[model samples]
Target: MSMPQPERLHLDSDAATGYPNSPLPVLVYRQVLDISNAEERADAFESMFKRHGWPPAWRYHLYDFDHFHSTAHEALGIFRGQARARLGGPNGQELMLYPGDVLVLPAGVGHASLEADDDFCMVGAYPPDQKPEIERGDPAQLAAAKARVAAVALPEDSPAGGSLAELWREDS
Candidate 1:
């Protein structure tokens, strides 16, 4: 089955708290995976992410506190259960994520899980050669994080099997 085009969400930088929310819009792909056999969904997501240059790094529920990664973009594939997450920061949008959904967050975009089902699980991945560093909404760390986020190289491929440049380029 062909994948659906992603829904993009553009967020602004939080001036007061210094959350350097990315200029690149967050991409959400709904029901992209076949979750009929829930047991194999993790493997499927892992394989897809690995094949597209985003190496699967972890399997767990999202953190309940707000945070962002300054050094790397991230891909989260929801393989089991469901969640209500806040994206962008304290003043960000609330989105409900279900199994088979994929969320692509650019570096510096804040995200946190507000609530989730008991069985909620997601597979997280990062771009090739990029390591994710957790950064809370600290004003002191904002400047350094912004610098690192700006210097992060864009990935050529997205975990969802398309040209990341085309989808993520600011000019796109």
Candidate 2:
């Protein structure tokens, strides 16, 4: 089967939220899941990420307020239900994600769950051996967050397994 092309968005820094969104664009892949069972879907997504060098995948619901990871990039794959999320800080764009959707968040990009159904669940992963440092719109961490974001290395490819290297390389 052919992979769906991802929708890309580039977010700017929000001074008020103190979020320095990445220069790398966030990539969203829609309808990527083949399994109907939530647990199975999560397992498949986690395996995919692990195969592609992203490890330590976890499954959970997203938080309902603005937050970001300053230390590492993240990939989230929706396994069940639907949700509306705000990306790129408080002033960021709101996007609706459903089961079978995948979102790739670069380091320093902000994200929060605005709303979701009771069954909402997703599988999240980071690059191999990397642990994400959570930052919640703190002005005190702005400078260091920005620096960490700027210094983060790009992933070799997309978590969904495609030509993200070229996509991200050109964007970077």
Residue 171: error of model 1 in Å?
4.5
Question: What lDDT, from 0 to 1, does candidate 1 have?
Answer: 0.91
Candidate 2 lDDT tens digits, 1-172: 6778888899988878799888788999999887888889988898888877787468899999888998888999999989999999899999999998989998999999999999899999998656788788777778888998887777787888876677675354
Q: Write the per-residue lDDT of candidate 1 for residues 42-122, one digit (tens) a residue.
A: 899999999999999999999999999999999999999999999988999999999899999999999999999999999
Best by TM-score: 1
- In model 1, the runs with Cα more than 4 Å from the true position are none
Report model 1's TM-score to 2 decimal places: 0.96
